[model samples]
Target: MTDQAVFPRLASLAGRLVTARGWKRLGLAALAGALATLSLPPLHALPLLWVAFPALVWLLRGSDRPKTDFTIGLAFAIGHHVPGLYWISAALFTDIGRFWFMLPASLLGLPAVLGLFLGVGTVAYGWARRRWGLTGWVEAAGLALAWVAVEYARGHMFTGFPWNLIGYGWVPVLPVLQTVSVIGIYGLSLLTVLAAALPATLVATKPSWRPALAGLLGLALLAGWGGWRMAGQGLGDVPDVRLRIVQPNIPQALKWKEEAKINNLRRLIDMSGAEGWDRVTHVIWPETAVPYFLSSDSDNPDQAPLTRLLTQIAPPGGALITGANRLATNEAGDYIYFNSLFALTQGGTVVASFDKAHLVPFGEYLPLRGLLPKGVKAVAAAADFSAGPGPRAVSLPGAPAASPLICYEVIFPGAVMPREGERPHWLLNLTNDAWYGQTAGPHQHFAITAVRAVEEGVPLVRAANTGISGVIDAYGRVRGALPLGDSGNLDISLPQRAETVPLYADYGDAVPVVIWLALLLGIAAFRPRPT
Candidate 1:
């Protein structure tokens, strides 16, 4: 064939691929989802979503039945999550002797379950497209709304696991991420899906670049506004308070062992008392730094041995914040456990405490516990940990008032703020990333923590076991950090809060709600002329 003929042929083949049916269409969607996964943390190639989302839109457009569309979405999610969450299996290897049986389930089962949300969203998108007789940009808009809705639902459904929302793609690019402060992460996500899928309109039967151009313009504005904010926003340092975050690099396998408890506690004390101990006002420790059950003696108000130790490490007038397991009894007489953070004074007094409200489904407690045999244990806890009252601002002496986020609680976007009263000046996130090894999990967790800081317009102080601990300014800039698998203390002054509260922090998810309504109204107003 001549050069001109060959070029046209390739274009024709590309068109056919977009309109393919059955397994071929499903394969394309799967491929697109896999590509989209690359845009997530550890390999933050966010531009890949431009190709991936367009492919998804094409698959959604070509599917004639809701069942087929559901499968297409499921395939996409499987492709997206299998690789996206592969690091989840890292926790299993920590106890290979017992958890070896769960390796396959750990690797594939989670994605399979989480993909159901995507499948439902696709089914809705297919129904809406067919019901409205929608096409082109209108169809793209509808799909974007549905996709964002599902992502939001995924973040909230069944205790919520919004690990790698589409908005997180912009995490590595700090300027683009500043938009989250205005609209929150879900709002950014709505725009992300729309911008990514808008390219599909260019390939439609009646190809028009107008929608694609609009998407590009929106993206340019996002970048420009973020750059302006970064330039103009005057983020200052809060006076008087200072921080000393200790990353003990404790191994997960031995953390709960009886023999290692004393040594582990000693390690945290040693790290906290390093060279700068006398100067710091707050000494922070990772989640569950004390391996023993802290609440076992909760009934009494007297000082526990752990409290005595913290007093020794903290300066004369300083406070210590650390994580531990607390126990309590329910009305039924069964003992319930909690992952908690305690702020202790140098005189061995418990000044304040915040129990973790959001628990990792399998890691902290098994879901559908009644269905599982009693012998089946959770990955991290032998007994299920009960949920506490949600996020609250815990007051520490000499230090600024702050909200406490134990372990995975920091992953939730708008949900991280205190339930009532004035917003805290900073966020204290205590986590143990040791379970997932030194893999993508910790990196992804750290990125999510940074986004929370920007969204709330508050500085974030993260202390992690075996990892990625750092002091992030309100603008998502890392002032100081101890890298993953490193045992050390990061001494830094606290970053000041923005003088004005960010729009998202004031009105959480209100922007996304407005976008959802707009999409619905567009679908209702859209009228196709009779043939």
Candidate 2:
């Protein structure tokens, strides 16, 4: 045979193999999305997480078109978000039917929106692979960097919804969770994406044995070290302060009715009275525990009953912190009502109050109110409440001062802290999960609260109406909790003051931002020229 003929035959075989590999890559990407979604709540099938990243890398290999890669990535993100966030539909199940459509709308819409970030990352990855030509370990670095950059954008883009970051999957592993004390959740998320993508490099290219072995070893070492740290760290021996958290479990339908206001107060006082409040130093009630505005004119008739009940439970130094709607006339002559946390002296006097700063969109207040339909506006009570200038820390007379978070405010990172030189002893989150019903929404919301405790290195006392009320320690450990659909009071001990601020508390998410910036710059510098 002629030498030229042999060369052409060899080239043809190589082209066929590459074509087959491309098909394999697309299949793998879809599988990865499905697997990753299983690791999220309602399923929490954990082992699937280990294979998710490897599958993504296999699926994207050798794809020349950036748009194709983006579509594949978007598919994976939709799989992960749709099933995981299905509980958002619970809002529609409430007494109001106006938002019935918003449930499925958000389920599909949120993923569609968030998938854009992954799409951007996939495009950048393809661009980097083409320009760099898989040389000098650059392809592996590019893929890892691209994924992390996408996650960063997911954490910050459009006011940021940092939920379901890959790092959160490690919550079940204590050692891995300890890493948050140094790097924060986003930093850990970056690390997690890189580790998961490392195995893909081996399958994509025939690199030196040394680089491949090193990559695998590095991931093992990181996970091992996290395990070690988790084992060595103690829960700490801080003095435990006795606490009583009340979950009135008030139904959402009756919460705001003028007639039901007195009934609601009686239920809370009766539930709390059963606890024999004498021994507890701090008593917490869930958000909107008081149906009527404490400062409103209609309180004249209800005041007598509330005062009598509060005075009856008046224990010498014990303080009661409960959620109430506070009405006040602003300087502009307009009446302003606030979702507030009021510290009451057993004698029924309002000693201190912290108004909620972060308001839920559509829930607390409708955006572009003038544009909404009349029917929609009528059902939304959140419109009546005005946002308080934020970061309010309530100080009880003799006890430790605490930073109070009302309802949805607990989910925002760094937004929960008091001003400099005013850090509180711990975080108190008062929430009403009744609207979520028996769905995973309450559990998911509570998980974020746990992360916040770890992020800030402060014990979290979460009081929820209709479930998941509990005490989470600095390490994200839930001690005593009342499950969903249960109406009860949890009496536990709060950890003493946390002196050190967690890395997240100090530097915020700056590390993740720097990582994302570096990845974008690297991708731009290495993007391939058009053939």
Candidate 3:
């Protein structure tokens, strides 16, 4: 009844799992991958990953040919991404009448394209293992490394959709989530895949339970280190910095209606200037809250209404930082439209502003418009949005210098901070999550936003039109908040930045890349010759 003796029996069962062929193997692979999606946000069922990854490892063992391995990996990845990203289709439902044709494309087509990275990555790394009849820890390490490699590439390649990384599974556990401040997300994902997959070693020819024990030890060490880092921390608040985040919970369909535009602004003003209006020093609004162009400072017929609204919403000495559209003539006399964050001080004086540097593809601008069939248009906006130069830290009246991230721009980890100037005191994210209302998209988006605060060692303040608005201190703790689909405003004191910048902020993804290379080297050194 010893550990070594029991595990060989597991090897026999694993052999049966490996013998699955054709339709049976494909179904099991897809099922395992689909189960893994539950490990993502709003669910965060970490134990499912234990089941999913080990099953994938055993399934990968069934095939020796590259074609067979690639297909298995493809089916597995397709299953994983479709469920994890199913919320994407909720945006189409905002105007379902026009976009009904895109349902299958959203649910199946997108995942099919994105999943190729994982499929190819598996074939590349798993090749050596099958060739040498590798087993035990070495084989598990190979699988773990391949998963992280694909995760990294999917995040960086082709506009890069890096949603639901394995690391985010730790978000529900604060102590575990703190690990991102050190190794960054990719490194966290590397350890996550490694720990989760190591149990598969129990099914190796010379099976031993020690590998599973080691995996548990890895989790314990990670938790111990994270617990220590967060141990005596308080929600360090800054002086004279109070913020009001207004969430009107407007529907995406009504947000841009010409008739409802004035009413929308009034709703924002009402929530912003509600009960505790006198005590608030600054007000924040979600992306595209105004819906109409708020004219520049110079005398124009449209300027009067903007000034009146600013007087109603702007704090006495502070400013109102809200999302708006900016139309300006370039040096060549061509008009450029930008999705932007503009700060209006008391008396309607325009102070500081930052245009969104990273624009969302398809949502902001189509990649190759000439290639697409005629009459097709970008889904999110009526006109294509121009990109800003890059990240900028602009000074506000009563708040610290802030870097503005509009909508999906906040999702990118290393790119949120200013590139050249002094580091901003805080991050200001304005988003309208109404596009994917009442779904996991907003919750997942908010989760990713919190991680950036920890990774950059700065407090983050978020305002969303349809909720998940909050103030996150430097440690990623939610100090103040509102839920999805809520109509309200939260009055919160701006939390102080962490005393020291995080290592990941200074080094970026290089921390994880180094760890990946080390794992690759170790796996190669320990490889057994082909049997």
Candidate 4:
């Protein structure tokens, strides 16, 4: 046989093998992303998610083009988000059909959008490879830096949905999570991306064994540093006041109904009574725990029962805080309903109230109402609820001044408490998670609360309507919790004030911003050669 003919046959066989391997890599990447999703709350397989990312980086390194890398990343995102956000569809089963369509859109849309960040990172990695013929340590560092930039963009763009950050997967790994006190969640996310991309450096390039060894050593060093920090940082002293968190477990279908109003108030009052409020310093009810408008209807009929229960449970020193719909008549003669938290003394006298400022788009208020059909407007609330003005911090008599965050507000990183010198001592997050049912919604929601506690260096006392009611210390430790899907009261001690503020609380994700700028400059500096 001629040498040319033999060479062609050998080349064809090699090409087929390479194609098969590429498909395998893509499959592995998808599997890894899906596995990582399970590590989040409601599953608690956190270690599994960490392993998945490195596996994904390894799989993607086999592909040379930007488009191929994007496809693999997209597949992984779909797998990760479909199960991770399945609870979003639970709202669809309610009265609104529009919610069903919107649920899928948001569930798929968010991940799809976030996956673009990964695509950008991978494209940059491929570009760097071709530009400098970089491999091993150089490739790994560049790709890690590129991914950090992507995470930063996802956090800041389009009102910024920073849920399920790679660092959050490290929640179960306490020592690593403690690092948040210094760098905040963004820094941890950068570290996570770096760690996950380390294995890719070894697999993708031909380099001396020393470079691979260095990459391995770097990961070990991070883990070791985290473990040391965890050991050194002990739980600070417990607070003087005892907090009681109440989870009503009310169904969303009947929550706002006129008929259910009386029964719901009675149920909450009964639960509070059972806790023996005399012993507890503060009693908390989940968001919108009261179905009726507390400020409207002088003859509510149910008020007598609620007042009686409060008088019975609330001792002279104790105070009661409950979630209710408060109505205020504006200058326009329209009755504005606010999802508010009201504090009351033993005699049912209103102490102070905080109206929710950060309302959920489409859920609490619809955007672009003028353009919508009249029929759609009729089906929705009369109009969007107006945003409350200023920070609502109320002195709880004997306890610390508490800053209230209703529902989705808890998810926003630094937005929970007042800025700088005006910061509150503790965070009170009241939410009704019943809308999302038993899916990952409640778990993910709870996770955000924990992160908030760590970020602000404030203990969070959270009350959820359906389940996952608990008390989280300053360091994101769940000191006490009620199981999901259960109706119960959790009595726990809040952590005392930490003299020092967390870096995140003071700086507010500044590190991620800097990283994003650096990555942009890096990309602009290096131009890709024409194919």
Task: List TM-scores for all candidates, in order.
Answer: 0.94, 0.84, 0.96, 0.83
| Full candidate order by TM-score, most accurate first | 3, 1, 2, 4
lDDT of 2 by residue, 1-531 (tens): 111112344334333323444445445555577788676554566567656765565456546688777877787777777766777666656654566657656778888778888888888887666656643245556666776677767765655576776666666666667677677777666666655555444443242334445655765776677676546445653453577898877877777788998888888888877745777766788998877667423235656556546545544676777888887888999888789887776556667888888776666676677897665642336446788878766787556678889987887666778757677878999998887787777877887787788788888899998878998878777878998888888888777544567767887777556765775576556644456
What would the per-residue lDDT of candidate 1 be over residues 1-531, giving only the tens digit for each residue?
A: 111112354346446655688888777877889999999888899889888887787777667898988999999999999888999999988888988988888788889888899999999989988877776678788878888888889888888888899888888788889999988889888888888887776665566678878998998899998998889666777787788999999898889888988898888888888787888888899998877666534335543665776677766676888898887789999888999988777767777888889888888888999999778988988888889989888778887789999888988888988858967889999999999887888999998988999999899999999999998988888888988999888989999987778888988888668877887787677734448
Query: Considering TM-score, which of the candidate structures 1 and 3 is the better prediction for this target?
Result: 3
Find the number of clashing residue pairs for candidate 3. 0
User: Candidate 4 residues 102-218, lDDT tens each?
Assistant: 655666876776777777767776666666654444555565666666666766576566677666766666666766766777777665665555544333324234544565575
Worst 10 residues of 2 by lDDT: 1-10
In candidate 4, stretches whose alpha carbon ends up further than 4 angstroms from where it belongs are: 1-29, 44-51, 58-66, 96-98, 116-129, 132-134, 207-240, 295-313, 370-373, 377-382, 390-392, 514-531
Better of 1 and 4 by lDDT: 1
Q: Name the top lDDT candidate.
A: 3
All-Cα superposition RMSD per candidate: 3.0, 5.4, 2.2, 5.6
Off by over 4 Å in 3: 1-13, 295-301, 529-531
lDDT of 1: 0.84
- In candidate 4, the residue pairs with backbone N, CA or C atoms under 3 Å apart (3 or more residues apart, or in different chains) clash, namely 39-45
Backbone N/Cα/C clashes per model: 0, 3, 0, 1
**What TM-score does candidate 1 reach?**
0.94
| Candidate that beats the other on lDDT, 2 or 4, i.e. the better one | 2
Worst 10 residues of 4 by lDDT: 1-10
lDDT to native, each model: 0.84, 0.69, 0.84, 0.69
